[model samples]
Target: MKNYFYFLFFFLIPFGCDNTKGNKLVEKSTNDSSSIYLDKAQKKNIKQSEKLKYYKKSFSILKNQTNDSITRSKLFELTKELYKNNFSEDFLESANLLTTLSTKAKDSFYLAQIHRSKGNYYKNLPNYDSSFIHYTEAEKILKKIKNNDGLSLVLINRSLIQFDTGDYTGADKALNSAYLISKKNNEIASLYAISVMMGLTSMETKDFDKAIKYFNNGLEIIKNNNNLLGEFNKETCLNNIGLSYQKKEDYKKSIDFFKTALKNKSIKSEDPELYSLLIDNLGYSYLKTGNLDEALKLFLESLKIREELKYYNLIVLSKVHLSEYYRQIKDTSNAKKEITEALFIAKKKKTHRDYIAALKQASIIDVQNASTYSKEYIRLSDSIRNVEILSQEKFARIQLETDEIIKEKDILEDKNRSLLYTFIGVVFLLSMLFVVRAQRARTKELMFKQAQQRANEEIYNLLMAQQDVIDQSREIEKKKIARDLHDGILSRMFGARLNLDSINHLDDPESVKKRLEYLNELKEIEQDIREISHDLSREKQDLINNFVSITTNLFEEQTATHSAKLTYFMDSSIKWDLVKNNIKINVFRILQEGLQNINKYAKANTITVNFRKENNELHISIEDDGIGFDVSKKSKGIGMQNMISRAIDCNGKLDINSSKENGTKITLNIPLE
Candidate 1:
């Protein structure tokens, strides 16, 4: 398990560039002259102004001829590249356009591509579940079209995500699928990336020799190519070989390869961070070879670069190295300080790799704290390994489910073929077919009735629960009123009555003054009773609108249940007499359902529930800071369906506007005379 944990930590280190590659995306077509991943976009060369200029040109051209396949395709391809290259402002526009175009065209190929784009987009957002959904949709479409290229791309994309999530087995299977496509197509560029990933997975299983073979194949594919990716690939190959050698305890060859990777111009210009990491890795190699001075110098240089860049995780790595160097040199104080800082960062950031490294190092230098550090290292190792296992199992489940779906589809196709062959025999069986159809219709009707019954029962339960809450609130209000009247108003009234009687027994000016004071007190008591009565009326009865009261109660409950902060307000000036009970009830139900949905899924930090009257229409809006889906693309779940039903029942319009990063907003409008 401990070995497995280390494998995960080293998982992507050999890949080189990592997410920084996203930043370097240059606009390129499929035939782009680059050897990196196919058509790697060059972001550093394209200024923001240039991107915006081209985007405006493309937008204007595409907007005028949206229905034109040529223009739409060009616009989509351009925007897709632009978005991937980190030109994010146009992403939503691209998504909206592609989705609209795909729907209008009703082309499975275009729709599949759209879903594929969505999966890629969500993967970048670190939304694995959404990515999985999009990928599944794309896979289904690809199967329908039998598009090997599309399937291979989906596998490659999903494999990268799976690897990041610690699903090594799943990642390997996906890479293997892509490997077959590469073999059949002779896709050198695709093969290069797939081989690297396969090699990384092999490393996880401790297959050093197999990992080397894959890395070497990748190297051969791009070693002589003049493209930017080719240059980057060469650097990747060298680094991975070096890391493999180091892992295998072959420090001399590892140090040699590390030095060669550092000299690559791509590493120097495009990724200084990668350069620093190589330096750090080389320092480890030097340390293993007993080159203390070289190791210390390289470690400090790496630390200095990381500090300048403020690369947090890399900074933790550099600090760990520095701590080890200090420990070697018998600088106990500095060793303690460096490792302590590294440990602090690891804990604060929840970086298991750094945490493990720091714990292991501390156990060596700080004997008194060694046992504590060792225990923590063991615990975190177990935890990381357990998560890896879960990820693997979940990925396997996804594969199994996907395979089952495909098998079902194949069976259905076979059954349809049999029906086609038996058509003439079946022609004389029309009467029997009708009878079967009628029986199916009856069964469908019966099922529909049962479903309807269940829905009604659920609605009734909801209403009952709501009523129970209201009743409890009423009971609590009654107790509060009783306490206030008895403890406050009654006591004051009793004191005033006693004073009134005493006042009649005196005739002096002071006695008269006391009588007047008693009368004032009596008047005040009467005012208090009136105030209490009004309070009871407000609490017990909905003054302005029951819709507002109910929504407020539900929002308060949601806020209490979740971590999200809530702000709510209802217009107090609206006349309740003008609003019908049916509309009020429907609106209340809609608001309740909407808020419940938000609480369950929204992972939001803040929410707003607003109620107002505008142009003789009651407008109720619920908004959240949670991750929201595209309302147009997202399926309407039963909760949303129920809300829509209630809105229709009230003769109101329900509008939902939502997106991933911006969140969801639901607006309901009901007419009031």
Candidate 2:
């Protein structure tokens, strides 16, 4: 019943450290003394202080030498190495010196690199806004210079900023752009970085299979270029692959991958953090497989290491796993203890995802308080989803602003060329504009007709609703009449016949007496039949009479309650039976609404409603003599709209004519067919 927090795999985005190599700054000049210092600074088996000394010596030598390509290249290489090694003070000093030299040499390429390196610096400081600004500036320069490799690397850096801000979709878009550029330019290091990033992005979106595929792609790339990824990088890929499989619930495969990652003996000492993660994941897989003993052992080992390192988030994760393990073993007390501690740490860290996880585990183990925990979990989960959506929108806005900045620069550069084509472009646009306007007018007409049709269908449903009620009442009346005829009239006639027969069997005197009584009974039955026949005829007439009665009542109400005088005419030649029920319903509704409108708005002294049959078409006209307003100018009210819709529903057309101080006339014509 309890859910546990899954271990989050850590994937490091490699920002192409290999790209720093093969600097053109001083590579051509082997005779320069600075080259020797540069080579020594790149050696792996060196102390930070020693590397700093060599870089400083190269900078000093190159400063005194002539500012030729060799001198400038050597100085740039020294500055880049300092930046890479985290010699902040020395790196700043050397970069400032190189900035002056490169500007004097008019080197746009090196200048752009400085900006990119600064962006990385700010990104590590977690100042995403500043980092984004620097990346944008570098991108502009690279685009201008048409250096695809530099542009690709800058795009990757921008994507990392986006990723850190919880804008996974934006990050994916940036990564895709970078991937395309890097692949086209055959930039291996950039390609590897993009693949790893894309995989991590996929994992964030819960596409575990896609993530595994991308991770495998990274491994394949590493296989071909051993120098592209170190042993630790390879270990990351394996761990991530394991995590993806775990998410997919393929526990056995996850265990295999996690074990393979843990096989690196030096991981425990070299990267204790990654080692803890691997073991915890392996333990969780064991828990899922019901291997309680091994699961508990690995869980405790991972928890102890995380505690030593004081990683709050990791500690919470381990406790959650332990809670799940305890719950599996039916050890409720221990499960409660572990989950409570995990929940406390998660809340203190304000780690929303982990907090939600802890809450879910709490709900399952602590049955008495499960409802409260579950409510909080749902609330936090919804809040985090909304926040992530907003974060994505914010990052998208930042990218848009950056694009606008570049677009402005391009506009300035293309100003003259654009001017040359403006006249011809304007002529073409004018022609297209006329065509578009005509098409849009036609589209609007079609849309209006469609809307009217929908309204007609809706009115038809309303009419059917009324018809259903009437038909139900008529059916009930018919049933009552049938029962009376069968039970009362037919039964009495049958009894009278039997009586007459029984009399005939007796003496002539008794038979005459019974025959006289039978005649009297027959007379009474004949009266019942006559009354029933008349009732049936009346019921049949009510069908057509229903419409007339309703219209008459409407007109009477207006005359009795209002100041206006109402007059209505119905043509005797019009056969009510020939008209469809739907048409009758629509005409009755329209006449009713039109009279009400006259009473309310058309302060007319006389109102007339005329119904006539002409050439197989039914025409209804309502005229009001009140101070009539302009028909073309007045907006159609809801009542008028309904009237028009009903008219259209019956295959009819409505027309209205009115003028100031003149009577208003509305006419509806519907085909009888």
Candidate 3:
């Protein structure tokens, strides 16, 4: 399983190199001693020792030379090819030389490649600590260069190291990180590889459900990416999912999955190892479900392939399976023979799980050595468990050291952020202080405006009283004139007419004509005086209903004072006589304040004021077409506030709506009742 991820990394994320330029440089360097020896080492007839010597000579010559782009490229390719061909000794030597050359040339990309190659070399050597160290170095370089693809492949390799050491938790962490990178970068191969490894690790941890889920995720990935590689991986994913179900004792379901995997025609020819594994799994599932004949046939077939392939670990497993199949049939003799062969191969290959399986089968089948096999089995199980614990500790220590380095970096970043926040906090405090002082000054200005408004209101009230007095005086004068015209002048006219009528009774023709003319003239004078008296009486009634007139005068004054053209209308239905004095006074003041605000700040060309009575409520609206302000924002100015206060005093609601360049409208509604 580890080899699967390791080889996949090579296939999927090969080292990036400028092979064209490197080849051109090699052509140019054909006459150089290193190039000559390097070419000679590539010949098919060369001995293995001669080839190694020539390769060393080539590297030695280049190592002493001044490093350049051409030298770095050459060394990078040579080391990579050697690593791929499994020339461990020559690969390590050339990789070290390349590292030196790349470091001198400041070639981060090649440096990372060399470290990753060395990591694989150490991993193949089975030196996990050195492998981890080299991989960490490579990971750091890849992260610095922002090569997400390279980083993800490196993480997969690291997870393999952890997985081999029985650190399933650590392996899972690394694979999860690799999965995130592959998902983000859309690296399909890495996604498939990481998911499969994660499933294997979950299996090792005995989390069979999670293992099945991960295997299914791998299957989904392969299904979406339909290619030869995906089709090949599909069998493995199904095999793994089946194994997970088997671990949960669902043999029937697992047999179905195994049979489905076997349906792939190329699996036996192309991937015999996976084919053998699937058959073994299916045979075990069949054995669990009582199909002994089919189970024994599959066990023999898998053992034949595993032996043919010389896979000792798999051979040991196959023998153990056959041993179990023989024991299940109650053939104690054949079971002992198979178990003995399995134990010999398992011990030779150090295949612990196969060895344990064989030991347990031996104890079950051979009563004579049952106690001996059982004791050895117990000791070996404890030993493997202890070793697993130690490996887990080692992995935890490696992670702890890495975390300490990251924690130190985070601390430095936190300190920098703290300094930045402190500077921002200081600036915020200074701004707040300035704002507070400005607000205090604004408060004083508003207070002055409010005091001036009160004074103006007092002056307005005095003027209204004075106007009422003038109206009363005019009424008195008109009444006195009417009384004089009707009571004194009209009474005298009646008396004179009576005297004329008496004289007419004793008149001659000439005297009668002159008396008649004087009587007609006196009658005409009495009619004129009577009409004048009636006119004065009507004028007195006009003086009593003067509020409308006073309002009209105020509107006229606004038109005369401001540059803006003003228009106003007051509802005749208001019946001012019924309204309380306070309501009238506050309503008038509010209107006055509203108009004054428009004149002062509206900068409008047209202003309109309207008053209407609806449903026993008086409504006033003042509107201006001006550069409007946002009514949503709080204003420091007290003019609008004063108008609102007056409206509240009159038990009215005031609303102002304004938008930039749209206009402003102020409306107030007061209940008459």
- By TM-score, the best candidate is 3
Report the Cα lDDT for candidate 2: 0.76
Error of 2 at 636 (Å): 82
Candidate 1 lDDT over residue span 480-583, tens digit each: 88678867877778777776877677888898887887777787877778677667756655543444555667777877787889998778767754566566
| TM-scores, one per candidate | 0.50, 0.50, 0.54
Better of 1 and 2 by lDDT: 2
lDDT of 3 by residue, 394-477 (tens): 556655575453446456456546754864565356447646865886788778977887787777678767866887798799
lDDT measured at residue 563 in model 1 versus the true structure, 0 to 100:
85
Model 2 misplaced regions, further than 4 Å: 1-75, 89-106, 232-234, 263-266, 347-353, 367-387, 403-673
Cα misplacement distance, residue 637 of candidate 2 (Å)? 78
Model 3's TM-score against the true structure: 0.54
- Cα deviation of 110, candidate 2, in Å: 1.6
